[model samples]
Every structure is written in structure tokens, then in C-alpha cells.
Target: MANFTLKVTRLGFSLLQSVSPRIAGKAAFRLFCMTPSSAPKGEKAKVAHAAGIAKLAGAERFTLALQGGGKAYAYRLNGGAIGRRARYLVTHGWGSSSVYMADIIETLAATGAEVIAVDFPGHGGAKGRALHMGMAVKAIAAAERRFGAFDAAIGHSFGGAALMVAAAGMLPSVPVVLPEKLVLIGSPSEMHWLFKDFGKMIGLRRAAQQALEKEVHRITGRRLEEFDASAAAGVIKRPVMIVHAEDDKEVSADHARRYAAAGESVQLHWANGFGHRRIVAAPPVLETITEFLTGDDSVREAEIVPLFDLPARRMSL
Candidate 1:
């Protein structure tokens, strides 16, 4: 069934690419940015896992309406400690809701720090079927407004890219207070790579791919090169921990290397066999993330091991 869906999607893209570059670009934009109305595979198990975490952590649900339109859903877990610990903000990847990040949120809250997990526009119970990086930045800003400043942030995949965009001050309308510590998991460092990959998958020519990038620049006011997360990591002056699975078929491990290479404060942890989605729920990865968020500056540097050096392990998302 999944293979059939993939073949159909590829065929549709190939047909669009054969049209004009502009047509292909428009279609790609919609397909990449919009969330489908139907739930993804394993959605039920994901939802159940998240619900269990929320219940265990005593999380409170809330909603924030954006200025332009659309609503963002969030779950807040208050700290149990006597005095306030640092506040942490967590967000899931594209096509996923905050529920998928419940385990991480619950763990952070267990450490006596208040935590908030947000579902971007068009995700979870949020209003809209389309979501862009701009909308995601605005949603994060809205969460901050509702629940004070966050000292640390943890993001997976596209959500991590959104954090970099927010920190770069690209979303001018929605001012963001960049968190002191950041953890990016299975994130793509360069936006152009994603565009190119999509183009190749859709059988688009180089010209058509360029057209798609141009469309992205027209909408976001930033070129594909300008939106690179590695560049953002270089200038952000904050401690960063990049966690990438060597087996992550979605985003390459080179992204982690790029971010870590950008600055001395950036640390890269090479994980094995977690693939893309499963990495988020891995216990060891979770432990490392929590320690980095609470630990001292020493945690900012680590050795990067090759994918072959790590042992293989099977885990479900």
C-alpha cells in the first residue's frame, strides 16, 4: 500500500514536471507545505504513546490563535520542583503533531523543568490544511508569548529547521527570543538539498528544480542557500547538540557534521539503526538530550563516530 502511494505520488510529480517549471514549482510548493487530511501510518500507536506520556506527566492542553489566522495546539507540563528550573520548548517534525514528542516532553518535565510541546499550523487540532516555515515560526512565537521565555528547545526534522529559521531572525513580524540551548535531531542543514531531492524524486529537470527554488525564495524572501541551518548555527552563539541517526534515510548524517563543523559549541552524536522517526523515541538518545539540556558547557563537545562503527539495534517509533 505504501509503495503504491509512493508510485502514484511520483507519477503525479513526473507529470507536473513535464508541464512547465512554474507549474511544477506551484505543485511542489503545495505538496511539500500542505498537511494531508488523512492520518499517516502508525498514527494510532503514535497518538496512544503521546497520550500516555501526557497523562503520566499531568500535562495541560491549550490553544493559541495566530495573528493572521490559524490556531496552534500545545501541551504544557508544569515543573514539580520547589523553585523554577529552566523552561523547555519542544516541537515535532512536518506532518507530525506534538503528541509524537510527548516522550521527550515528559522526560524534560520529569527533570523539574517546565516543558511545552506545540503542534504547528495544520497539525494535530490546529486549524488549516497548509503550513509553511513562516507559519511554524509564528506558532513558536505564540507559544512563547503564552508561556514565558524558554531556556532550551528540542526539535526534530522540519521542526529543527524551523528553529534555525526563527533564530536567524527571518520571521520579522513574529519576534523570537532564541533559546540558550538547542538540540536538533535528524534535521537537514541545507534547504536546497531538500528541493533538489524532491525534484529528483519527481523526475524534474535542473531547470524545473531551479524554478521550485525560485518559488520558495518568492514566498519566504530567502534563497535556498540563505536558509542553511549550518550557517545559522555558526552565528547563533548558543550551545547546540545535533543528533542524527546514521541510518536516517530521510535526512543524511552529513547535516549533523555540517552543523557541528560550523562552530566549537556545536556537538554531534552519531546514532545507529534509529533511522529517521525511530531516533526520536530512542532511550539512549533521549538520555543524552536531557543531559545536554541540564548539564554544563562540557556537554557541548563530542566525538563524531562513523555510521559503520556503531552497533545495530532495532527500535520502533
Candidate 2:
């Protein structure tokens, strides 16, 4: 039944392309931002994981009211009133919640630094039915306002792009504090490519693509070309680590390479077989991210660990 519904929807959009490309483009934009999957199963497991991490890290969970409307769900681990080492902000990708990033949050918390993870608007417990890159940036800015400045930030997929956009000062009216270090996992380098891909998927033609881009520009006041993460990387002074799996299956590994090529400070880490979502929970990948964030040289000095040699675990994404 689900497959049938999906087919009908796809067919309808395809037909719309022939009749009105402009309308098709608008529909494509809506579909692009919509979360296709239902809420993840294993509700008890997700709760258990969150509870265990909170206990281990001495974390607190709460909600913060968004500026315009709605609310964002967030968790803070370690560093209470007394404060701690460094502070790190973490965010998840589209259609994902902060619970999926529990492993990363737990690991960061273990370092004695305050770690914050948030479910962007429309995902997790946050309010709203639709979300865009701009809103994600705004959510991050709100998190920062409540939690204070961050020494480093780690973002996965769309969340990663928001971090780059924030660092580039592209988010309107939102005050942003650029983190000293950044980690982008399986993130796209160019927003235009994403829009174009969506156009192709929905059978939209050149005119339709232009219409979609213009719609986005209406909201963001920036053209598709202006949303490039590579450009952001060039202007931002912080060191960036771009991690992508060789077989991402979603965003191409070429995006990571493009980011690495953007500047001397950008570093690329290649993982094999981790794919898109699994890369975030891979043990070695986690270790590398932790080491990079904490500035630990021991992990690298010990040996070059082969990816996928470690056991894979189920994550919330």
C-alpha cells in the first residue's frame, strides 16, 4: 500500500511536469523538504539509549521556544552550573532526531565538555511540519543563545550544511558564533546541485528548475550558487574535517573532496562501506571525530585503523 501510494505520488508529479513545470518545481521543493519515513521503530530502545547517555554524561533534556514560533527539542550533557572543559554543539540531518546522535553525544560528554544536541524544527520533538536549510541555521542559533558559545561543532548531512551557512554569515538576522573547529559528515558542498537533482527526480525541465531556484531565493534571498559550502569554507578561518564514506549512496564523496580542495585547512577522511547514515555511528569514525574535536594525537599516532573492521551498531537516523 505504501509503495503504491509512493508510485501514485511520483506519477502525479511527473505528469505535472508536462503540464506546468513551475508548479512541478514548487511541488518538488515541498517533496524535497518533506520527511518520507515515518517515526523510527524501537521506541523503547531510543528512550533507553537517551536515558543511559543522560545518566552517564549527567545530561539534562529540555525544550527551548523558537524566535518566530514553535519549539526546538534539545539535550545538554556535562558541565552544569560549575562549567567544564570545552563546549560542543551537535545537530542531526533531515528526517532525523538528536537521539540518533546519542553515540556521538555520549562520547563527547565523556570528554568532560558540555555537549549539546538538538532536533531541528520538523524533526524529532521540534514543532513544525516542514523545514529548510535556513530554519536549521536559525535553530542552531537559538541553541547557541541558550547554551552559550561552542568551541567546536559536529553536524551530519543537512545539519552540516547549516553549520557552514552559519559560519558564512548567510543566515539573516541570526547572530552566529563561529566554532573554532567543525566536522561535516556526509554533507553536500553545493545547494544548487541538490535543487537540480530534485528537479530531475520530479521530471522538472529547465524552466521548472529555474522556478524552484527562484522560490528558494525568495525565501533565502540568495541564489543557488551563493549557497555553496565550498565558498563558505574559503571565507571561514576555522579548520574543517570533511568525512564521507566511499559508498555514501546519498550525497557523493566528491562533495567532501570539493570541500577539502577549497582550502589548505580543510581535511578529508575517507571511510569504506559505512554508507550515508551508518558513517555517523561507525566506531572508528566516532573515534576520529572525537580525537579531532578533543585534539588528541594518540589515536592517529597509534596506527591507521582499517574502516569497517570494528562492529557496526544501530543508530537513530
lDDT of 1 by residue, 133-240 (tens): 778888888888888788998999989988878877775566865999889999888777676766777667776678878877777667777877888888888888
For model 2, residues 207-233, the per-residue Cα lDDT tens digits are: 777878887877666777888887788
Candidates in order, TM-scores: namely 0.85, 0.85
State the C-alpha lDDT per candidate.
0.77, 0.76
Q: What is the lDDT of residue 23 in candidate 2?
A: 87
The numbered model that scores best in lDDT is: 1
Which parts of model 2 are misplaced by more than 4 Å? Answer: 1-3, 14-21, 41-58, 296-304, 307-317
Structure candidate 1, residue pairs in collision: none
**Model 1, CA-based lDDT:** 0.77
Candidate 2 to truth, TM: 0.85
